[model samples]
Target chain A: MSKKELIVREEILGSNKKVAAEIRGKMEAAGVLVVNLLSSPGSGKTTLLERIVETLKPTHPLAVIEGDIETERDADRIRRKGVPAWQITTGGACHLEAKMVGKLLPEIPAETKFLFIENVGNLVCPAGYDLGENLRCVLLSAPEGDDKPKKYPKAFATADCLIITKSDLIPYLPFDLEKAGNEALDLNPRLRIFVTSALKGRGIAELARYFIESRVNMIQHQRHA
Target chain B: MHELSIVASLFEILEAKARENQATKIVRVRLKVGKLAGVVPEFLQTAFDSYKQDTIAAASHLEIEEVPLKVRCRKCTAEIEKEDFVLVCPSCGSTDLEILEGMELLLDKIDLEI
Candidate 1:
């Protein structure tokens, strides 16, 4: 029996990356800032997103694509806040693929300045896929404990920013802010961090401001380059 | 699990490559997966075994090379290898470190018979 060795060096996720780049190109041409939000189930991602939508809708046109294993619940919640929302039911897939997100881009409002793609509530699988977003944010609620950064290092390392949500519950939880923040910093030194609580409206304004400023900065950088 | 999806993607790549080379069957697939890539090798193998049936890779073998996490200390310029996720520099104990290696999931090569 004769065997042949073929040196085929290719990426397993090449198709996904290609689609992600195409999505990024489309978003750039439309002048919309896309942000992919990642977190564990019950990590307050929806609550924080509701706050963001409420605060930014008047000033900036916004849209949302909600990903879930099986539901239109999150999308409906965003729609009630007066923003256009689309739901992608993964049906059993733990994470959203770039191709799936690309298909829904046309449904988004053309004038939308900010488009938030709330990934299925999974830290592990979502971290491996890029959805062609301008920013990637990972949220860890105080109730989830501070060891999440250490346990899910890939999520923290791949994120552009880290959000510590449900900070209002810090007093009742054993979560240490310093430890969590430090662990995330160790994984990614350049990660922008925000401590927020949607219930008290604490740090919501700052978070909203960050999005605005980040969009402006990206536009400026693109212009200069 | 996500491993199943990853295996599906792998099969797609294998099929395309086999078609390009006009190969009748795939013999072995070699992959490089880093420690920080967040994939369990055992799960990936199991997924491959279940999905390879009736495909060109039905009788193929999968070999995964686990790459260790490596980092460079910003302060001392020392390159360190770590088994854990902690990014501290062993020499200086500084948290200022840059990841040089790890976080790679690549399909390196495939052996085939025409």
Candidate 2:
């Protein structure tokens, strides 16, 4: 009963990472900025996307890939805003995998300038997978309270930007904006934060401006490099 | 919920490694999971148990080693093992710290019978 030991140091998400890189390369080549939005359910991801599409569609050819456990509803909503939208239903998976996103890229409109992939509404599993986005944004609604950063540090830490969504509810809720923003900054010092209320259209313009400027900067940087 | 998918991916890795080594049966699979990796060990174990039935790792023991979150203080250069998701420096009480060890999910090694 002699047993031999094999040292195989490999990442479980290695295949996903490789496919994500390929998708990133494709998006970059096509001059499209991809953003992956992650959050818990009812965090107003679809609402925020609706606002973004309403504002950005006039200037940019926008597309959306909505990921849900089982729904074409989000995709249908985005399509109503006059933008191309696709839905990738995971069936039972908690988060969207890179391969799943990659398979739907060819279906996106050819002239899309901005591509938003609203990841499955999950704060935990979504952090473990990268969908080859130019930016990864995690949204925390004001009603969710300030302790979310402390509770789900991985999601806050991995995010490039943290959006405090539904900020208009602060008058009714006990959400401390400063505390939540500081806590997220502590986890990830480089995170760019925005307090937005999609329903009121507050901070929507600034967020859209940031996205446009960043995408332009990335393209120029890539060209010079 | 995602642990099941993680265990499925782990099984794929284990099968490939076992095939590479010409091992007929896997004895044990060792994984290194950091606290900040967002994986629950018990959930992963349960998922592994349910998913390993018809695979090469059917009789293998799943050994998971938990790694504590470690960070380095930028101000005091203090290395601290943190719990409860606190990101402050222990020595200087500064929030400006770099994470040294955490957020790791690695398939470390496998013990197999050839």
Candidate 3:
């Protein structure tokens, strides 16, 4: 009933961070390269994952944890591609937390060389939380305009790679691809941008190649360490 | 958008901390919200107020501290406050920059009454 200073010091995501670190350590020890993919609702994360699975099914053993607010349909879409994928329905939450990922890690096959976490379709909260991933990719669709990096700097700031989806529609959408890339690079100089279209199959091979190299590098680095 | 759910988490922490200190209620909950945290304080406050009833933080006042976005310019070696999405170095107009602050969302302190 009275005013008193409690001095309760704590991180806003203290609990989530703890669980994320554990998941990161576990994945690192197991030689798994975890990639957390974040993007807007229509940024084409699910379609891109399906394309990646199709392209790398023969080489990298890949699995996905699909995060959505309402349905398991995304996971089902990935599973239909003949790859191992699970869905984490966040209920009403806008983003996926580490605990949700930690719970699903067990269900994933141990032989998974690459683990992809398709984060809930959002640009804000997902960019703030680190889900124990070796790489964080932010997707921007051509239809979404090139000013996305300027509008959502946090998402671009946290991304290790930036994928511009639906490149095939670039001609019709009046998208400034160069400006988008420059904006993203301004936020993160090290971010690699990949322009691709799941429908046209453009850049899918390059994306697959990058993932393959990452898988090799991850294992090699762990082995030498 | 998700600040409503995050408010729930914040209350959970406040309640546990208040109970641990043998407090009857929490008075003030202090938070540090980063500029890039994507959490609108107005939205969080509304959500917190509605959700705090019947909880330990029923009568607690939310004190929000806003942290400005700071980025380190790799080209000019200067740190500047980032106001917009443009990650440019004000000193040198270079694109090489690193974020130093403005992404933090932490519970810095709290006030409780026993």
- Most accurate candidate by DockQ: 2
Q: Give the TM-score between model 3's chain B and the true chain B.
A: 0.90
Q: Per-residue alpha-carbon lDDT of model 3 for A1-225, expressed as tens digits? A: 565676666887788888888998899888888999999998899999999988888877889999998988998998899898888998878899888898888887888888999999999888867899988999999998998887888889878899999999999988999999998987777889898999999999998888778877877888898
Query: lDDT tens string, model 2, A86-192?
Result: 99999989999999999988888889999999999989999999899999999999999998997888999988899989999999998899999999987887889
Off by over 4 Å in 3: A1-4, A220-225, B74-76, B93-96
Ranking by lDDT: 1, 2, 3
Can you tell me which runs of candidate 1 are displaced by over 4 Å?
B74-76, B92-97
How much is B81 displaced in model 3, in angstroms? 1.8
Candidate 2 or 3, higher TM-score?
2
A116: Cα error in model 1, Å:
0.4
- Backbone collision tally, model 2: 0
Off by over 4 Å in 2: B74-77, B92-96
- The per-residue C-alpha lDDT of model 2 at residue A71 equals 71
Better of 1 and 2 by TM-score: 1
Pick the winner on DockQ between candidates 1 and 3: 1
Per-candidate TM-score, chain A: 0.98, 0.97, 0.94
Q: Each model's C-alpha lDDT?
A: 0.91, 0.91, 0.86
Task: State the fnat of model 2.
Answer: 0.78
